[model samples]
Target: MQTVCNIEQLRTVVNAWRQQGLRVGFVPTMGNLHAGHISLIEEAHKHADKIVASIFVNPMQFGANEDIGNYPRTLSDDQEKLVAANCDLLFTPTPEIIYPKGLENQTFVEVPDVSVGYCGESRPGHFRGVATVVCKLFNLVQPDIACFGLKDYQQIQVIKTMVEDLSMPIDVIAVETKREASGLAMSSRNNYLNDAEKATAVNLSQTMRWLASQLASHNDYDKLLQQARAKIDASGMKTDYIHIAHARTLEPATQNDKSLVILAAAHCGKARLIDNLQVELD
Candidate 1:
């Protein structure tokens, strides 16, 4: 795969693809490549003639106390994975290039309502950073489709909402959350977990799965969620939020809501993990 660091070079290559009438697919990531990320690129191959993947550990998406400096950056290994996935182009830009005018004056994109609760509540200004960088990437790459993992369920929703609200001409495709045999959602942050914490991490996805099964028989969303929260807390982790909400809006799921999802976030040792399971009521 050809790797370009500057926008002009990236545009020069992508524009040539456009002139040739070839459709392009894009996958934006924060390095630290894993099976889950590769899965997105694989999915992108099915949608467009060419795939473009980007790895820029976005500082805009991280908070002051967040692990931006320590976030993993395995570019050499990541490049190998991308090439194996048959990605045609890889855009790896520095933070300086991404924010040439400095972050203080950089224009940002925000999708209201959908960006308010869940992860947003705990990590303020997080989605603002996400929306902004994604918008910039969308502008730079100008792909026909962008693939995101459903592991970050709210993030996919936020991006979808942003594209629709802004009328950006690109389709946002969400690939299924890749997981281990133990049901732990594969995440770059999983590297932060110690031996004991790694064992406990599976409980996040396990609890989400169990809660999904209960949805078919129970209408008491509040009680069901409280019980799930308690189960996670008893497993030696601090519960951030264990909520059942409308899949699209992220609003609290009501009895009449047919499409719903069970989303949870918890802190175990130094890593904060999140997982979700979608539910369809008959």
Candidate 2:
């Protein structure tokens, strides 16, 4: 795979591909590569002629106390994985390269209510950073399609909303969440979990699944959420939020709501893990 750090070089390559009549697919990611990330690239292959994957651990998305400096950077290893996955191009830009004018002066993009609660409440200005960087990437790559994992359910929704609201000419595709054998959603942050914590972390997904199953027979959103939160907290993990909300809007799910999703986040050992399950209420 050809790896280019310069923005102009990336645009030139993409422009050349466009001239050749090749449709491009883009997957934006942080550096720590895993099977889950590779799954997004694999999905990208199905929709577009060429795949362009980017590895930039965005500083803006991280909060003041979050793990910015300690966020893993496995560039060489990630490159090997992308090459094995048959990715055509890898755009590995430095923070300065992305924010030439410095982050303070860079134009920020926000998507209002869609990013308000859930993870948004936990990490203030997180989705603003996400929307801005993704906008920048979308503009730079100018791909026909982009793929994101369903594991980050809120993030995918945020990006979709951003694209539609701004009228960006690109298709956004969400691949299913890849999971460990024990059923925990695969995440780069999973690296922080100790062996025991890794095993315990599976409870998060289990609780989400349990909540999904309950949605069939139960209509009480508050009670269901309380029960789920209680279960996770009893497991010795600090609960961030365990909410049942409208799948698309992230608003609290009402009795009349047909499409609903159960989303949860928790602190397991040193790692903060998030997982979700979507369900259609009858």
Best by lDDT: 1
**Model 2 per-residue lDDT at 214:** 88
List TM-scores for all candidates, in order: 0.98, 0.99
Stretches of candidate 1 exceeding 4 Å from the true structure: none
Roughly what TM-score does model 2 have, to 2 decimal places?
A: 0.99
Give the per-residue lDDT of model 2 (tens digit) for 146-234.
Answer: 99999889999999999999999999999999999999999989999988999889889989988898898887778888999899999
Position 97, candidate 1: lDDT: 99
lDDT against the true structure, each candidate: 0.94, 0.93
* Model 2 residue 211 CA deviation in Å: 1.1
Consecutive 10-residue window with the lowest summed lDDT within model 2: 216-225
